[model samples]
Target: MTSIEPEQSSELVLRLKSGDVLAYEIIYNVFVKELLATAYKKTGDRVLAEELVQNIFISIWEKRESLVIINLRAYLFGSLKLSVINHIRSLVIENKYKEYKQVSFQEDYQDTSNLVDLQDLSGLIEEGLNSLPTKTQEVFRLSRYGNQSTKDISSKLKISEKAVEYHITRSLKRLKQYLKKFYIFLYL
Candidate 1:
């Protein structure tokens, strides 16, 4: 493990907290390789690992003013660990949802009554989706229905990954609010 002396790490942290772009660049250059290696070891996917490291640096930059770091390397590694875990959790949930959708679709196909209810629910959800901005709706559909990764969506949409995330997050919040009344039991 690479360890920085306390004094140097403290100085770097102070620079980062002050929103120094040069300090941010220096810190990124210093830690990016190690962070990428760590993420790759955890994920075993080069592209995903790269994206994870990039997102971590972007997060650090965006949240610079609120960042409090006693040890910059430790903080960066901790953030990487959390990001990997969250990514894994999201994959698991997405897989489960995909399975549920497949099974439900099969069941609905065999039963006219269930198919009617599903059609109705699908219509309501479509209406809610349509209420979002065009970009947000497109992003949400690409993620949820097309089963595209954020990186893929960003590339296809010619938007940043952060923008993709932002759109999906906003779309979900709006959809939840709009559908909560009718789907209260389903949500609970």
Candidate 2:
């Protein structure tokens, strides 16, 4: 087990390095089951352990030409240790992502849709009002929200009724253009 009988293993390594399929098969047959068991014990996951063992064999075959192994059994087990560590790290990252998604879903569901929309629309209206000239904004608020007639607005402000109508029209046109980006503006 230490060196596959310690005498023939050097010959086996040389042949395996020279791309001898039979030597590779002999090494795999000797070590695969033990490696699989070690991987399974470390990972506690049968499928992942089997896959890790398979990858270890594949790595040995791929690196045969460059390898300088004093003990093949130790090398395979060392590879298994690294694979198990990587698997555990991936599980931790996956758990963190699941937790993040769950928190995001709860936050999304807790938000009141109507309240959000109303707040957004009010903000847009306030921004549009700020963009208007002071007199036009005053005329628009009185005519629309204050329920004042155009003649009353003009009389109170000491302007002609025609001038009040012009201010209201200008303010409405400017606000319409400013709010055009919002979907609710189409209905208004």
Candidate 3:
């Protein structure tokens, strides 16, 4: 596409705005090469560059009547620059999302695996709890599983607060001893 005078350019713009297919074709042929080159050089991806330039042409044709292009060359280049920036930003965000998913999935897998060990330790704790007296077992379950405070347990069971504390402490000590060989002892 050879250079056109200002008058010829404006005339082409008018024809394009009036839905002249030939005028649109002339504009595309003239600038597509330069626009494609700029997009490729800036983005360093030939496929993406071609897609960006194609999108710009499609945009110009679709919005011809609404477009306020003072200089066609400048407008095309500006659109290409903005498209490149937006595409790169989207790629960066996509990569970050993938990384987050990968890390989170691994963490969740580890937690899921740990849950099985916790369940095993829970079973072992329950087994050791049987060795305690019935009253001691009742007090420990009320405080730990039933979410009752020592004072609440005392009021409910009609036992002294000190008695309730003694039972809970005894239950913990017994469970700790029972689980001493396991890593669950660290948490206790």
Model 3, residue 86: C-alpha shift (Å): 0.9
Q: How close is candidate 1 to the true structure, as a TM-score?
A: 0.57
Candidate 3 residue lDDT tens string, 76-101: 88999999999999999999999999
* Residue-wise C-alpha lDDT for candidate 2, range 29-80, written one tens digit per residue: 8888888888888888889889998998898899999998777667778988
| lDDT (CA) per prediction | 0.89, 0.85, 0.90
Q: What does candidate 2 score on TM?
A: 0.57
Structure candidate 3, residue pairs in collision: none
Ranking by lDDT: 3, 1, 2
By lDDT, is 2 or 3 better? 3
Error of 2 at 36 (Å): 1.3
Q: Sort by TM-score, best first.
A: 3, 1, 2
- The candidate, 1 or 3, that scores higher on TM-score is 3
For the record, the alpha-carbon RMSD of candidate 1 to the native fold, in angstroms, is 28.3
Clashing pairs in 1: none
Clashes of 1: 0
C-alpha lDDT of candidate 2 relative to the true structure = 0.85
If both were scored by lDDT, which would come out higher, candidate 1 or candidate 2? 1
Top TM-score: which candidate number? 3
Candidate 1: list runs displaced more than 4 Å. 1-3, 113-188
